[model samples]
Target: MSSFAALRRAHADARFKCIFLRPTLASQRLGCPVSPFSCRLNSSTSESHVSDAPTEETPIVASEKTVPSGDDTLFHKALTPSGRRDLADRIIQDGKELHKLNVELKNLQRFARSTELLVKGSPWKVAKHWFATPFKEDVTLDNGVIRVGSQTVPNIWLRDNCQCNSCMHQETRQRLLDTFSIPEDISIKTAAEFRTAIEVTWSDGHQSTYDKDLLREAGANSEKKAVIRQGQVDIHLWNASIAESKPQLNWEPESRPHEKRVDKFIQGVLQRIRRFGFCYVNRMKATPEATEKLLRRIAFIRETHYGGFYDFTADLASKDTAYTNIALGAHTDNTYFSDPAGLQAFHLLSHTDGKGGASLLVDGFKAAEELLHSDKEAYHILATVHVHGHASGNDGISIQPYKGFPVLEHDAETGALLRVRWNPSDRAAVELPLEEVGKWYAAARKFDAILKRKENEYWEQLQPGTLLIFDNWRVLHGRSAFTGKRRICGGYINRDDWISKYKMLHFGKEDVLKNLAAG
Candidate 1:
């Protein structure tokens, strides 16, 4: 016989013996007549061979639930061994519980949908009936309106008095009515004829219904007519135009008479400072006369130690002791002083043979603005936290400490930004309640990340005869280390001086103090 035919006959013989010969009594009870050949083979095969076939067939028997084995069902045996009956029972119970939960969820969803439909049908009416009724009953209305209590609402609700963008274009500041004045002659034809919603007939005779609450909010019942002003001054204009204007740097000698071009340049620089809090002046000789001329043009000059005309020559013996060799990071100079110098002026006398000295300026105001937009809560924490700085180790002079000023300060009356605190290295640990310390650190980190951004950086090499001036409070200045000799003559001029000079040039000889006080 062929090998495949032999294997098939072997499998058939094994199945026949297991079905008919192994369970002779059971087969006989069911009227399944055992074949003689199957009985002869079962008797000839070893007991082990017969046991293997019967074990395989027993699994099939358990699968059909024909025989109960220790109360375990056939489906349970299919999923797991018969020994894990408790586990199978738990799984079945869990399935039943999940089905019950699904039914409960469907019932809740149906109720929610029904409630949403009822509320959306008449949202305003429903809200008024619920919250406004008790107060409404206490208010009274004259003419077509019945007396509810003390308050009075007009029967004719105004449809045109809406604040939506469609009715009032926010960008253009245009309202539905160019002249938003209430109608002068409003008359009720009959008390009974007037409904809660009076049809509003416009000048063009088109009619629309308005809600009673909306009309009251728009001052419909007031005796005085409402007129909306269209062209109010926008405060954002001052700060918004800072980045719009081109920056300028004026360079002229103090000894020479002010030319008309230089005069206009100084005025522009001052105006830029007032509007944007910073400006730059370039291309002038770094002589004491040139530096003084620029400083004098400002309102006031703040003199520091080793004052007057000086040179930054690298000859260790050079007369200029004011200029130091130390490389500085971004910082407002003299922050350790009581009233930190407001405006800083630097004149590059000579950078002969300097390999790597470049001046860097950063707008602290812009950095703070970015922080406020990203996370207002973090911004608030920074504004509330107090920071302290000191330079006590080397210098014998102890500077007055600063307190209670916000990193991003805004004017309370005008809502204009006033100052920024961005010194990281020198910042002292602030004493706060233990709970608030963590939040303060988080806010400080956010502010630092924004200040360090490359986009906010403005860098330029201070060539010979270049003078740059900026608001010390708003602009943080720094420089890169130099390989060769680099020299710079720098000093401070107060902001009040700069502002006075700006006002004198722009608004003629008008007293700035008088104007400021008036404002």
Candidate 2:
């Protein structure tokens, strides 16, 4: 009973003001006196109705037609309990609806200056003064969503990101609330704009005041997140022009350039690979472990059936073509993988013994771009047609058919080349419609011709004490048949792992990685 009396007083105080001060009356608009039980009298000498309420006072029983308020529902035994909830629920359902009744009451509107305008049900100073700049359209809210403009932000998302004292630690800027505690279908009770922020009182009575700048940034971040989920790779398109000024980073690994300077140099190399898809490291460590150590600088060596790392020599009778004394054609490795290795590093341990092992570099992305501009039909056909592959002499005992991909992979929405898979040696069988298979072969031929163009091919005689690393997704690698014993050591790195290392190296954090994915 005492609690109920206290709540009534709080509610009354919230809706009314002291008339002794000559303050405006909200009931004036209704042309009636405000219920003394619901409104506070304005006077320091006047006693409040709540303090006067006694436990022995006769209970004012409500009629069936009378709706129960938040405080009204609390006097169960005294006034006959009814089906109702607390104040929080009432505010969400019908209290001061912005679209109905007085828009001022619904929104955080300007205070009334004229006393004549003050009336019952008028948007008087409810609790505190609020300066709000509202949106144009009527706000729409749902479970985990608040549609503001073109974007719909998740309620749970917004609540979790609340920068309030209860939600986050001020000094650390670390979240304090448990994300899982938020209901999956949580809804917004009321939404209004402030001069610099938007105030949202949730159905659960949790209030979130987000800055306007924060909401705008959130909308942008939401769109960027969606884009990242679709395609996490960025690329640079080029042709023979890539050959004119190769994206080269000539740094000696053994020299151990000053730490800060070396870090910048490493970052530059990574940037080159990110932009041009390949980079050359001149005067690098010349050893069997050179390529392996270099991979650690970026990420762990991608361990496939090839074990960890390898030394390519003129082992004539070896099962793998790379090991034999044969000319390898222009191709990206790991066509057999669904997500192939992204970075490939080659260190010339001993190239003097070799005769014609000059590395042939061709940009598959460059070829695809050319084909796309000159022949859109060919590009589309190649991009759509899927080709199967198999790793014949892999270390794995069980021979499982590797997942396949089209010769050219493009984003359906942006028509951007996402990945390229071309390996004649690893090609398995063509499993496609008869009509489509012929078209695929023709498209592949045209793309291959572009790759084979002399202007597009950048031949570099990889010398000892030099390390060459290229993007397996963009630049195709090949080697001319060699005579003498050539010893080349290299390794493959997972695409995602390399990207992760690159992002961390350049940005020193993961938050900015999404921006790098865009062209």
Top candidate on lDDT is: 2
Q: Which ten residues in a row have the lowest lDDT in candidate 1?
A: 223-232
| Worst lDDT 10-window in candidate 2 | 122-131
Which prediction has the highest TM-score against the true structure?
2
TM-scores, all candidates, are 0.48, 0.62
The 0-to-1 C-alpha lDDT of every candidate, in the order given, reads 0.50, 0.62
TM-score for candidate 2? 0.62
Name the regions of candidate 1 deviating beyond 4 angstroms: 1-246, 252-263, 304-327, 393-395, 402-404, 429-431, 511-517
Candidate 2 — which residues are off by over 4 angstroms?
A: 1-149, 154-157, 160-185, 190-201, 206-218, 221-236, 240-243, 252-260, 316-318, 394-402, 513-519
Please give the lDDT score for candidate 1. Answer: 0.50
Residue 27 of model 1 has an lDDT of 33
Native-to-model Cα distance after best TM-score fit, residue 148 in candidate 1, in Å = 37
Q: How many residue pairs clash in each candidate at the backbone level?
A: 10, 9
What's the residue-level lDDT of 58 in candidate 1? 39
